[model samples]
Target: MIELENLSYTYGGGELLSDVSLRLQPGSFHFLTGPSGAGKTTILKLCYGALLPTTGRLSVFKQDIARLDRDQLALMRRRIGVVHQDCQFLDHMTLAENVALPLTVSGQIDTAQREDLSELLSWVGLGTRLDSHPPELSGGERQRAALARAVILSPDVVLADEPTGNVDWEMSQRLLRLLVELNKMGKTVLIATHDMSLIRAAKSQVQARVLRISQRQVQLAGADL
Candidate 1:
């Protein structure tokens, strides 16, 4: 679980986020919704320890982020998965290799894991693209492939930014279903998206708390999504 208490961030001589506090409990599902440039992604970064808060405190699994060393931070990240708006993969590598990058980095990639890699890709509907390079995939395919990569490690927390931004409605629902399934399996999930329809759909199927970022602050979504 992740907790942020009175978190504030400043950039370029201006405040981007202020007095933000929230807690993500175990097996909780959260949707972070905000307009463009409202710091939705910044909150995600803070949740996963990508950026240290300029003020206030952030703790991951009960450990204060400011107190963790580099190695400790790395170890903490192994329990969290992040999917960015723009998926980045080495053009030289196949889709499977890109999805398995986390395992390789954590030194958990072995022969059996390699087999699980295939099953994971199939779950994301990318089985046929395992050997395909990044440039060869369509936008939706790339997004699905990114989702596969994010959860392949079976991290306790999944932080996604605009995960369905590029996909059509059908594909969006497909991706959402996978996420809901993960939450049911006891993984804490947090997704940052601007699409209210997506948030509404998720609310119908899962007990997801919608948080809206507005006026440089974060709060539970009110009469919005």
Candidate 2:
């Protein structure tokens, strides 16, 4: 669960977000949409504590993000999984290794976990890409791989940035299923995307609240959720 109250963020001496307030509850699903350079990514950053708000308050799991020390922030992050827009990965590492990187870095990975990881990669349709590097993957493959990495730890909250941006319609539907399944299992999920069709498709499958970012404020997108 994450909460932001009257949140504002300033970048390069200009305000990117202003007077935004939203709360993500447990087992809730949300989609954040906005035009280019409209601070969608900035809001996601604030959610994950990547950037602190220049004004107002943000709390992650009830702990004031601004008050958390480095260790506290690290611990909180482990509970919140994020799939970045760029689908960032270590190009030098194989795709499977990249997907498994989270647990590996957390010192929680083992042979048993690797078995489950293989299943996860397979679930994301990346079983064959295990030995391939990030640079060798197609756009859709990279997106799925990033998603696998994001949820490998089964975090309490999942934040996906432009999750369906690179994938085709069918693949996008598949990815949406994965996120929906996670939400069904009681994990809070937030996604930032510009895909209105995707949001429209999601309307019937789940009770997702579509939140649109317009004019630097967060407003519940009308009727489309």
Tell me the lDDT of candidate 1: 0.90
Q: Candidate 2 — which residues are off by over 4 angstroms?
A: none
Q: Assess candidate 2 and give its TM-score to the true structure.
A: 0.96
lDDT: worst 10-residue window of model 2 = 109-118
As a whole number from 0 to 100, the lDDT of residue 111 in candidate 2 is 76
Deviation (Å) of 86 in candidate 2: 1.2
For model 1, the run of ten residues with the poorest summed lDDT: 216-225
lDDT (0 to 1) per candidate = 0.90, 0.89
For 1-225, candidate 2 gives per-residue lDDT tens digits of 799999999999998999999999999999999997998889998898999999999999999999999889988888888988689999999887899888887898777766677789998888767889999988888888988898888899999999988879998898898899889988999999999898888887888999999998999988745
lDDT of 1 by residue, 3-104 (tens): 999999998889999999999999999999889999999999888788899999999999999899989999899899888778888899999899999999
* lDDT of residue 195 for candidate 2: 92
